[model samples]
Target: MMRATTAAAILLLATVAKAEDSLIEIVTREVKGCMDSEHLGSIGGLRSYNDPNSAEQKCFLGCMLKKFKALDADGQYSAEGLKTTIQHCPRMKSHPDIQKAALQVADECNGKVTGCSDYCSCAPLAAKCLHEGMKNKSFQTIFIALDEALDKMQS
Candidate 1:
């Protein structure tokens, strides 16, 4: 009987560990997909934010805001819309840290230079400010409860 019990416990532990690993895999894959070559133009890639002044970096951040629905048609901000968009990222949508970082990005970088007269300003300011607010490491680490981050971001 003791032998049976020990075997059962070992199986349970293995199952739990496998589940955790799977969860981490899902989140990592989903987030990486966003900045893949296809979408890098919009969302800054790994370390792309380090040089916030570059035109590519600027557009990267600005386009990411647009993609995330943080910016509306007129370039204004909508918290609700932003939340909706963030949900696309598996496990990250409802995370408090992500919400805080996103809000910071919205408040400070949303319209930094989005006006028509200063169209060029939008990219640099948005990218720089957003990069400062949302680091890649923070993004990966915030969604601790991998199960919660299971939903794939809407395409």
Candidate 2:
């Protein structure tokens, strides 16, 4: 009975892992579509999160936030939406620290970009806040994954 239970646990884990991979793939495809639709120049040309973003880059970031439902209809940062997004995204879900940092960033940036009716302006501010807040945290891998995803889309 113990051996059977162990085998079932392992199988369950494998299934969950596969599901997470599928979720990531679906999100990546959606993001790639957004990039193509937005005519984002080149992922390589994007400035660092701390640097000032060009209009196109800002719009692209906005598109991403919208696709992920991190921003509300009015282009405001939605903490609840962000939490839901992180919970569903395997990459962010697996990293509790990242999840915490993201929420904190949302809290800090809340209402700070008020009156920005478009994501192009609001999303960049929120992203910069997150980038700065997580600079000392162990979140580099997430950014690296994003870079890799964008690179793959380029090809």
Candidate 3:
């Protein structure tokens, strides 16, 4: 009975390991597809973010962008990228250019952000907002309009 129990445990462990491996494979393939897609722009920009000394970091970030289509030229940043940025980058933001790029990418995933209104669903509007903000334009006009429309919310 003890031997039988041991064999059962081994089988269970092997099955769990196989499941994990399959998940990794699926994720990697998805990322590869996104990276190779023509819509996705040059991944050269993102390549700089990964630590040169850490192969794992490099692979992880690359896989992330590729899987989610965040590097797409036409602003195809996947829901994953936006969710990640909104959750993580708010405090630990990096280079200005990267921040801007991240915002732009997040704009592409506007639909996924919880509580983000439908009015801001379109990418063009979000792109315009990000572009103008990045350009150092005083958002006075927009701020005033929003303040007036939603006075308490602005506070």
Best by lDDT: 2
Cα TM-score of candidate 3: 0.22
Q: TM-score winner among the candidates?
A: 2
Top-down TM-score ranking: 2, 1, 3
Q: List, residue by residue over 81-145, the lDDT tens digit for candidate 2.
A: 76565566544555555666656665666656566778888877766665565454434322333
Q: Taking the tens digit of each residue's C-alpha lDDT, what string does model 1 give over 9-113?
A: 111011223444654454445444534633444332223234444554444434444444544555454445555544444434335455555555555554453
- For each candidate, give its TM-score against the true structure: 0.39, 0.67, 0.22
Which candidate, 1 or 2, would have the higher lDDT against the true structure? 2
Off by over 4 Å in 1: 1-48, 51-61, 75-80, 87-89, 108-120, 135-155
Tell me the lDDT of model 3 at 149.
19
Clashing pairs in 2: none
Global lDDT scores for all candidate models = 0.40, 0.55, 0.32
Q: Write the per-residue lDDT of candidate 3 for residues 54-109, one digit (tens) a residue.
A: 33333434334333233233334344544453334322143344444445545543
Mark the regions of model 2 whose C-alpha exceeds 4 Å error after superposition.
1-24, 47-53, 136-138, 141-144
Candidate 1 residue pairs that clash: 88-153, 91-149
Candidate 3 structure lDDT:
0.32
